[model samples]
Target: MYALLPVSPLYAGLALVPLALLLFTLVVLRWRAHEAASVGMFAAAAVALAAYGLSPEALSVASGKGVWDAVFVLYVIVPALVFYHVIERADGFEALRTRITAFTENELFLVLAFGWVFVSFMQSISGFGTPIVVVAPLLLALGVKPVYSVAIPLVGHAWANTFGTLGVAWLALVQVVEMQSVAATALALGVLLWIPNLVGGLSIAWLYGRWEAVRYAFPMVAVVSLIHGGGQLAAVTVIPPEFANFFAASVGLLALAPLAAWSRYATPTDAIERRPVMAESIAATDADGSSPTAVADGGTATAADAADPADDGLMSLPMAALPFVALAAAAFVTAVVTPLSDALGSIQVGLSFPEIATSFGVVTEATAPYSPFSPLTHPGTFLLLSALVAFVVYRRKGHYEAATARADEPREAFSRTVLATAIPASIAVVSFLVMAKVMDHSGQVLVLAESAANVATPATYGFFSPLIGSLGAFMTSSNTASNILFGGLQQQTAAQLGGLSEPLILAGQSAGGAIGNAISPGNVILGTTAAGIVGREGDVLRVTIPWVALVGALVGLVIVALNAAGLLGVA
Candidate 1:
């Protein structure tokens, strides 16, 4: 008996049913993420057992793996939320908004600063949808419409999905596929990803003011894209892939100062006052006489002020940014400093699973230390460190006030905020991961990829490759998971098609996975939950779906051209 189902259209269509149901619930039924994901998880389990010949033991193993993966992600999500709430409680967002507006009240600059630049930075250091969850509310506090706040960051930081988060996704791809030269593969992915990088910046501008915003922001966008895309490529040549996004995003952050100082962006234009992306209620309030700062803080003193007054004192921009600065420093010491990383990475935790096989012969090999996690070197460790640092600093500075005069009251408040946000987000992420694992372990993922590859000639395989990768991400809501799920299949397909370039195909797969983050339901949930619009995930998806489709198509074309031009090894 075959270890897996033979490639066939019927099986492939069956494999897609779970994802189809997921989309139906999320988009058509307009269900909440956690609710929809639970239904989809059950659907995936049913499909695996009924159509794919998944055994009970194998299903249990896959579900276990899913929960473990969810733990890894939640480690980051919970700490990040703690950090956000810690800052928000201190009125740090209001203070930061005030300071930023003092420098430039141009809505375009502000949007790009938070949505594009800052979100990219966050992705670079800490991904797993951390950037979207953290930055969406920051944008909201800057007075961006709630939907736009979540949607913009969803689109903005997606280009960094592969190499960001300390290159976890890229590392996953490398692990799954036996590439001839890792450097060449990284370089190829870097080049292809630049298109999305440039497109992301311009898209944020367009979202702000249509074509007019794009025209005005073109020069700045170009410059930032160079630093972001070009810098990452350059870093890949000299340094390890792990620090590629970190270096580029840090440079991009520094460049913001000079870019903001430029005459065009520094002077407020009529466009600033006519923010098409903002809510009409807020716009009218701005027109009537309310300062943009007041509108930014929820349109009244009682909203943000009555909750936590800034009367004590406003923190300077640097003071407000200290937690992030600490996060960056911690990441640098652990990731970049060779001696420290080695020492800290030595202590790792992982689980062992027995080899499990389905009746259809789909066998998942047993492995020791599967997906080992280094507690000291993991991003979550750094996030927690940063949170502690922020709490201590802010507390020392008298930034927090308690409703009750108890010493542990602040700790209680932090716990409540974290639980309120982290619980729903965790449920959704776990459900998505579980569904993806069931599909993978049961051979449904392979069947889907092979079926697509079966129909495409070598000439056309390039186009379908990324779509397969995107499908993986749409299901899993993670570039790393997408790459792991499809990377080997892509490699096998490339070899089977004698005319195809393995590196180009794999690059397209990774690039497509990166762009797929825009449409991932789990990521969309993170954004909506953080932005305080949990049920409106469909609203945000409406905006991001087109961008993902457009960019995925563009990536396909680029792969087709490169493959045709015989630039396989060079790219």
Candidate 2:
């Protein structure tokens, strides 16, 4: 394909038209993701037809393959969403919030709890802006300024995008690039992703209380970040990327308790306090998973907290966390347990695409087995299973009766989730997939990438790599989309550079897309809407853009350094 495409100025620039349209609609026009992707998809199809001599049949087959590929991600979205709302209705999030108060009374640490750990944990399981939707409100409710509320979680969850959402973005990158050395790319991504992990934690702390609080929390942050970040890199060496975030977060979650205890005695004097504003009737929970109370008895809150299951007494922290626990366990067992995974893997379902060739002789190959959907091994299966478990637990604990007092409430919630998320999610997923396919099949990707390789020296390309990744993410508001659109380009550019390692360069691309999650306009708008601070999107953007740029620059620099060092088997 690369050899077939003449990397001419006109062809390269023309090939970029679709991508430019997508980015403009998303960032400048602030069009909905579905709408922008629609424009991009059409633009790509038109360009392929007029510029690349693509045939209609080839385009149809390529688009069909995209639709099939989209199934893998969309399935994850619907089930994860249903599970999240089910847990929310169960007061599970509140219970998790209450549980954090047990760790420390430091308001800064509380910010860290919600912003760093909680959001990261949520991102690990649920993608599609769930972390910001779920966590920002909690932060706002805790008296953080609206901007800080959105900014904190926005920055906090960026690091989790690749391995998080059960490797939705990571899978997109690896599969699309179709690297000869999958493990090498995975490993590089693991280590490279840690840069954002550490940045996210510090950004949250700094946003909460500036340098003073960051200084106080520095020790805790470093220790936990090392534990989680280092653990993730190590996990990828053994386990797949899907399980890396889970393994890393679990290690951090356990290590945090000891860190909390250590903070008690090693407390700094004149620590910056994060004072809370008045909340509604719902009391802020204290440590030990107790709901807020009017009075404190011997450092223990004494009250029938409204957040607890009033009709069935307070739900245990473990019970409150049952869905997540079940999900983690299910993923682990299915992934590691051979018989179960094999049984599930065998039940494959997908569209089998026949090989098709464009008029320009660009051939999109056939897949004999096609895009397979493993019924049991798929993350969506676990999500659905987890949602079911959460429903049963929430019901048995009288959560339904206490809150809704209706038999069909659960059904309504599930239906509402499907109604709200299904269409938009489908539109966004399909549009990007179509655009990716059209561009690839018509040799547009090859032309653009080869042109880039011709234009930039290896060092300049290394520095610009993250910016390219960021541009894709900013346009689509998805790390997954960025990888789908540009991962192949990154891989091709690395090969064309003559001495660069594909994995090493790809790490920067992946990391940049992850970091860009914080400043993507769609994400900013989502955060403001979810946090109940509409029309104040500018404020949120103002606070986040600088941090995102700084982190993105550092990522580029790191990539350049690694490329020059010839580390990780750089050619």
Candidate 3:
């Protein structure tokens, strides 16, 4: 019966309705963001319930999955944002902003150069939306228009989306393909990224400010790309893939000398120039329930600085800087320091779904690893640690004062964090769960995969794989999910058609998922929101889609060339 079945085309088209509704409701109808999200959420849930034929048992299973998804988001995303928020509340972002602007005032240099380097750094440390979240505001503060601020990061950082932050995309790819992961193939993929990453860097720079600044900083751009791209590739092949981003960032940090040497053509440094001033008043409360009142700015105060007397109680720049620097260092150490990580591994939180899942023949009771021995180990833990450290640093420095208008309490911090991030995250989780359930119940992913496979010729698999990958990202709005859905299908088709090694074909799948993230509607929405250009998502898409297509095509061509050259041997 299964073999005789005609695949349902409706399932594929049906999957798009929610996204379309999002466009219509959010863009055309001009609904509030939350309202649009709510409508999409319910629509997806209805589809899932209807398509899946959810009985009590099935509903139970779906609920379990949804809860887990929410937990994952809460555990990882919420803390990261909270950490950022606490620092912001403490006036650390302002300090960091001054330091960056002081270093480079040219908008293009800040956007292109800083965007590439900083995005790469963040991706290596924390891959999921980290680049967009961190860089968008930084760009905004540097005087780039809010819209371009988000768009630039999305475009330039797209190439590294696969092997980034210790190869999350590759890890997911392994699950889908069910093959022994190849470090060499993963490394090769990262090496190949240099071409597109460089191109993306240049394109983003030119788009940000034309030839004025990027033209002058060409050598620095080249060196940064080479160091970052090369170091990432080397780490994956030589060390563990988990260490890829950490090592790359570490090495790239050291390459500042080479980058500096390459910029010898410039008469004087073209970086930002800021005046020195006294540190601002910092009034942030610590995790330990104490508020201090001495915050220092990263730069000196100047006559040109805005004088907002009402905000003088904010924390100093150095206090704010602690969290970011600490977070990066902790994440790096946690991934690399096996002894410390293993020790922290002792504090795991095992989640059990006993009777509820078994009644439905679904697996539950997955372990949520939480080892404080590796206190700074997980990305979430690192972010939390950074927040804690920021509190301490600021308090000790007298940047925070206990009796100065408010008490330093963890309750207030929790409330603000939940209000800002948790609400949005809940909406996102519900939407994704319903969509996944709908696709699974309707057998949509399988039908779509088969149809996609039948459409391509052997020579065109390279090109088509990326398109399929893009479709998956578009549908799911996640590179990880896209790989999970299509990686095996692409590998199987490659094997059947041309006998290509499964790893290489699977690698192609992973690569495509990475590129597709740039234009994915969900990513665009989140990025635009973070960049403060909410309703203008279509504008960002119009600019990003072409670049995404071009990069995917380039990756596809390389895959084809590799296959033809016998570089990826037929099994």
Write down the lDDT of every candidate, Cα atoms only.
0.81, 0.71, 0.59
lDDT of 1 by residue, 1-571 (tens): 2444767878888888988888888888988778888988898899999988888888989988888778777777777777777777777777777777779877688889899998999889777787887788778777677878889998899889999988989999999888977888888888888988999999999888888889889988999999999999899889998789888998999999999899899866774344556654353556566643343422112222123333336778998889878987887667657789899999989998779877778898997867888888777788789879988998888777531232333454556767876788789889988998898888888888888888998899999988988888887788998998889888887887878778888989998899999998778877776776766777778789899899898989888898898885632
**Residues 1-571, candidate 3, lDDT per residue (tens digit)?**
1252234566455555665786577657765445566666566556545553334565555555545544544455556556655655555655565654444333444455556777767777675565676676565555454556667788767766776766667778766665644754675467556656777777775664456545655776787677767777777777767667656665765665344434353123344232111121122223443222222211112111224234355554555456767877886676567798778766655344333222213222333331112223456677678778877777676654532344344435546644554466446545654455444433445556667677777776766777778767765666787888787778778767874645556666777777777876556655654554545565666667778788878877887777666674544
Per-candidate total of colliding backbone pairs: 2, 3, 31
Assess candidate 3 and give its lDDT: 0.59
The TM-score, computed over Cα atoms with residue i paired to residue i, of candidate 3 is 0.76
1 or 3, greater by lDDT: 1
The model with the greater lDDT, 2 or 3, is 2
Candidate 2, residues 211-264, lDDT tens digits: the string is 876787788789878977898899999987788997788677777667667744
Among all windows of 10 consecutive residues in model 1, the one with the lowest summed lDDT is 297-306
Candidate 2 wrong stretches, greater than 4 Å: 105-107, 118-191, 209-213, 230-248, 264-314, 405-414, 465-496, 499-503, 506-549, 565-570
RMSD of each: 4.1, 7.3, 8.5
**Clash number for candidate 3:** 31
Using lDDT as the measure, the top candidate is: 1
TM-score of each: 0.89, 0.74, 0.76
Which candidate tops TM-score? 1
Q: Worst ten-residue run, lDDT, model 2?
A: 296-305
Off by over 4 Å in 1: 1-4, 234-242, 272-274, 280-312, 402-413
